[model samples]
Target: MISINNLTFNIGARALYDEANWHIKPGEKIGLIGANGTGKTTLLRLIVGDYTPSSGSISKAKDLKIGYLNQDLLSYQSDKSIVRVAMEAFARQNQLHTEIEEILEKLETEYSDELITRLTDRQQEFEQLDGYNIEYRAHEILAGLGFSEEDQKRQLNTFSGGWRMRVMLAKILLQQPDILLLDEPTNHLDLPSIKWLETYLGNFEGAVVIVSHDRWFLDRVIKKTVESRKGKLTPYAGNYTFYLEEKGIRETIQRGEFKNQQAKIKQEERLIERFRAKASKAKMAQSRIKMLEKMDRVDDVDDDNPEVNFSFRFTKQSGRHVVNIEHLNKSYPGVPILHQADGIIEKGDKIALIGANGRGKSTLLKIIAGTETFDGKVEAGHNVTMTFFSQHQLEALTLENTILEELQSFAPTYSETNLRSLLGSFLFTGDDVFKKIKVLSGGEKSRVALAKALTADANFLILDEPTNHLDIQSVNILIQALQQYEGTFIIVSHDRYFLDNIANRIWFIEEQKIKDYPGTYQEYEVWNSKRVIPKPAPIPVKQEEKAKKEEPRPVMQNAAQQLKKLNDELSRTEREVETLEKQVKEIETELADEQVYSEPARLTAANKRYQEAKAALDLAQQRWEELAAGIMEIEEK
Candidate 1:
């Protein structure tokens, strides 16, 4: 649907892409990935015509529609409600519907055949456009993106910047254009919303190209991977995992070839130098020099991956119970976030708090950290020193302070060498440490905050979305550091892969309660799948007695027939529940595989099927329980 030939783009004097060629076909989902500042977002802008390439050409079908979601939110009507802005995506459909309405009104006055034909044609067009379901689909998309019904009714300006970005995303998805260009779509979404978006994009019937730093999300939504680096574009036919493997192999081969060519060149040079001084071998030396001059030199392979090394050190140990919460309740005016919640955090326990947006995940973290006030009791165990990191931590830094100064402020006694060494481990080296905090990007600021947190000699940590602005590599480094720390921590993050690797327990906040599941993220998912079946309500006493009385009557024959019918239904429901449970387990197992997670289509299909089966199993189990109760009542009589 879109084609690029010999595309060249430059930022100032540096060329980001040179003679790059790529083609995106219909229904293809492609991931645009690379390290930060590699022009991934710039390339998307060039494709969407927001920026022109320095040279070469890009083309697309003349009539094809393109939906582009930029990393930065566009200026929209702030006074409009969220739903109103989203529904604007269907402006053409809305226009057509209005025309149809006008035609129907005109038909009441003029009964001419021409008028009737025009009305009929317009009505057909409206129906063909699916105008009737536009509002319903808009609502579905908005809700799936984490907008509450009340939130949708509020003015757009009332929302935070992150939520406003989500509104923009909703508008783009609602448009359903022939091609989708998304840059960091999941940056503002929670885990549940990210899962919903994965499902939506999986079922999308158009071409998609997305630039994101979210490794797990990219693994679950994209079919192909395109990497941008060092003025070149490299296409990998498979997903991110395949791309990684193929890239490794390519780099290895290139290194080998480069080494071989260098060795050959060195040998030839030595031979030429040694023989050039002798009159008898001068001709041979000249020939060797010429050959060396004409030889095609192999450029040394550049290492694109850089490592960040750091670890946390604790000065003291906490008690067995790091934190204890009893009868925790938090509320604001008309909203109740948490109610009568209790939880215990033991030493060395790494807990992940997860839920949809505005579900009290952050609030609970604050309450536990004693940063926010609540009407409950929260106690920290003996010798429990704590460090808290939040998005606001980046903003809390003195903007005028250099990176070195920022770290020194936290630990004033640390020498210059110590501070620089710690900063270097977080990817800020030499002159980078001298840059003012105000000049740093979001990712850089996040690194500074993380470095400070790591240097703190606290044994308890509370981190809220610590990976928000960090790239994939930095997140891995943080995970490794956290893995080695002998501290108790509670983290709230949307990065599933990070949580899966770092968290040993799951603390899920839902419906005003905190439920603790004792296992890793993958295990929690498997257990939660089976626990979705709610307990059946108790049978009414009068209904049970009625069944008992009818069992011994002349209606005994009817009772027997009813019993047989209930038995059959119970058997069918039980079979369906068992089958769905098995399917869910199988999919969960597949999802646990790193390779399977990289295949977007397979992952999406498995997730969708698991959800469907879970719903079916829940209902079936409920019905089966009801039927079994009925049979027992009949037998008792």
Candidate 2:
């Protein structure tokens, strides 16, 4: 357990935290949230003792172990295999194993009772630590985090920064520390890995403090929400959604109180002004002034949520079809990414290209943008002015140019006022727009790139991981802008909440082919979950049916009896399928309820039931289809 009391931290003259107090209890899953530059990450560092506070103290229980995962770990390199790196978490067990091996080697040469006793003690301690299966546990965690068996055996230094970060995550998870401090942990994770982490953290026993922009993950994992604003930490009893609702209510009450206080102050000031001119009321007026001076003034609530009010206007409308891919065959030397894949992006289509990592989402995006090479045809429709945004574009920004200048240079035809307004929506306001691009942080550069992309006024947009460095507020701004824009866009992102809100269709690559799910992300999830049943293969001809063709057909009475038996079986399967279908629907309905989604235990239980029911329903439906075909064949005979 950790208790932060009167935590005052400052960076030079800027105070990041002022008397902000928070108590992280055991087994509590806390979501630390706020806008960018609000000190959420800084608070975590203060708790971890990575940064010293200006005053006050961060106290922890004696000998408490903490695991902290951050972007900095991306730079970590090791020559050891990933599994070995993760297994390093079991320090004592590994040491004991080595000592036991040494003893065994010595016993091979010479026997000693003392050595035997030491070996026995070491083995017992190793068993107590579960050291024998440490490697297996490491492999299991690595696989869950998206590493294949071969990948687990590869040297950690060979993997990219993202994959290395995953290895670091695996190591931390294997440690099982008393508390977990994760900052933007989902940034490097794909949808599947993120979900796996969600399940892992749900069952984690220690306290967890997560600072993530991933709303969906927070909603599913966090039990409490803490907001860092104006150098203060405010706690909410529930998760992110509850935090939003509760914050809104609190702000409304604060506004009302502020309004009433202003009214009272005005009434008293007017009375003081009128009475000051009279000799009899002069003393009374002075007393009233003293009372007004002593009264505590209520501060007005700040608007943390900024909405996009700027309109995106394009000069020309795009053709009915935005993009058309024909026989898209793309692959590397050994890996088959896509072969004979095809998809169409139409006008007004908001598509979310999503899947696990290394599934060719980014490659497909580049293909559509006409940037990457391929052995297929990708045609853009008539009058399709396009703009593509990616992480690489951030580096393309002119370092000397100011944020406002960057947008202006990109959109020379647009008015400066319009460009500034767009930048403001991206959280670069007034003087902030005057800052040089080189001085901005990665997140700020991302915002500038996004703003410039929007100013292009293109009818077709291709964006890859646009929300990578953005905070929750910045993401909301982009979502609002997209919601207002009438352009067709295909985006690849791991942020499910953003995709669910903006995308009308889902595209995923599977089996070396492009696939489309013509529905929202939520609907696609439900359909995809039950889509486990593979297409039925050609029904094998039964021996009786094969003999029947050469021999004669069965007698009329026998055929009738067989048909009745099939009909009875069909009816029973139909009833079972109906019941299972109803059960799935009921579980889905429960999942849709906010109350259930807000509770991690309830959500996990409901999802488990839903999966079970869906599997049953698929089996029953498959059986029914087989029976129906048999019935139809008999009738034809």
Candidate 3:
């Protein structure tokens, strides 16, 4: 589709791409990843002709269609509805349809071979443009991005900037260009929206180039990767996970080459020194000097190590249960974010908390970590040391302290030089160590916050969406390092791929509640899939003597059939009750339990027996419902 031959671009003295030769097939889904300021964005801009390269050329086929969504993508006015803005992408296709209709109308009155052929050609074009499904597709994209039917009719100007970005993404997805380019597309998306995008891009017919900080998103949507580093764009086969292992292999080869070249340089240096003192080899020295001067120097090959991978070796171990929360209730001004949320994290547990945005995911983390106040109970394990990383953690950094000094304070046992070396693992090296905390960018500040929290001697790590703003490389580094970590972790993240690789259990937060799932992330997904219709096949009850004698397995079959029938009814009743509850909440005022006008003893007794006799699967599903409720209450609070 698009190709770059000998591409080179520079910012001041730093070269982003130096004579880099790279090409992407027409339908390839490629991820552009690298360290900060490595020119990933610049390379993307060059592809879209937004910026000119310093040298070399970028070639593209004529008549090629491209849809690029940059960080500064245009947004609709707040006053405009979401549907109106998203419909703009289909304008060209709509016009083509109109023209085809006009041609057909003309053909009804007058007929000619030439005119007939032209009409047929226009119809084909309209079909190819998906003119028939344009409106449907537009609505589908908007709805998947979290815009409700009511929201679609609301004025766009009334929405926040984050929501406006969703409108921009919906427009891009609707266009269906030959090549789709997205930068940080998942930043504003909720779980459902992210999943929708993954399924959409995974099957996209056109070429795709996405720049995202979401590790899980890249692993699912991208098929290939083009990474810019050390002044070159290196190509890798497969997705981000594939690039991870492949990049390790490539680094090994480069390291071997670097070593061999260094050995040769050292041998020549020794020879030149020895020859300088000998008159007999003066003629040979001239030849060696010419060889050394003409030799093309090889670039330094850095070590093949993950970034921001600081070790957290605590002096003491935590007790059996690392952290616990009971009946947690929290609320902020204007809305209730959480109501009666509960959770528990034992030693050696790696838990992931996931929900939609503004659903108290971070709030749950803060409450558990004791960084924020709550109404419910929170208990730490015996001798359990805790560390936390919040979105606002950068505010904790001291302006007067250097990077080295900050590390020395918590990990003070290590020498100042050693502390600086640890900071280098997080990309703070040499003069960067001396720079004040206030001088760093948002991403850099986040890295520093993560480094400090993870490096401390703590038995438990409470990380709230730690992967936000981190590139694929940095995210993988943290993923691998965390997998090797010995402490318990309660992580809240939208990156499903990361959770799949590391988390042993799930702490789902939603509504005004928290629920726990005892299994891997994959198992949780399987359980969640079952919850939609609840196909939990109950165990067959024992057969009676008469039934066993008459028809053998009839009793078991009858019980199984009965269970299925009950389950069908249960699902229907549950949906009806849920619908009624929503309607009731909307219409009736929230009254206290005392205002129910019922005897407390009878109500409590009836609910207990009904709940106990329920299926085990439904009982296990309580956590999800509670979490969902917590999410709702948290937002309301």
Q: Each model's TM-score? A: 0.79, 0.83, 0.70
State, as a TM-score between 0 and 1, how close model 3 is to the true structure: 0.70
1-637, model 3: which lDDT tens digit per residue? 7889998888888777899988878999999877767887788899999889999999998888888887676444646677778878888776776776575555555655676567558656866876655655666677777765555776676565666788888888787789988888887676767998899888889999988877778888998988877778888988988998997887778778878888998898789888977999977877887898898876666653555435558889999988778888886553466787777788999998876655567767877777778797899989998889976888888767777667677677766665665566566778998887777777678888887887788888988778877766566777877988898998887777778888998976544578778888878988875442211111111111111111112232343454454455556656655654554443333222433213333333332333233322243344345445534443443
Task: Tell me the deviation in Å of residue 534 in model 2.
Answer: 8.4
TM-score of candidate 2 relative to the true fold: 0.83
Can you write out model 2's per-residue Cα lDDT over 1-637, one digit (the tens) per residue?
8888998988889988999899999999999999888998888888888899899899999999999999989888789988999988999989997887677666656666687578669867987887656776787788888886566767887776777889999999999999999999999888889999999999999999999999999999999999999999999999999999999999999999999999999999999999999999999999999999999999999888767778888999999999999999986544556889988999999999998877678889988998888988899999999999998798899999988888888888888887887888777887999999999988789889988898886999899998888889988988999998898999999999999999999999876688999999999999987532221111112112221112112333455676787799999999999899889889979988978755545655675576467656766786799789978867776
Ranking by TM-score: 2, 1, 3
Residue 276 deviation, candidate 2, in Å?
A: 1.0
Per-model lDDT: 0.79, 0.85, 0.71
CA-RMSD of model 2: 14.8
Alpha-carbon deviation at 285 in model 2, angstroms: 1.2
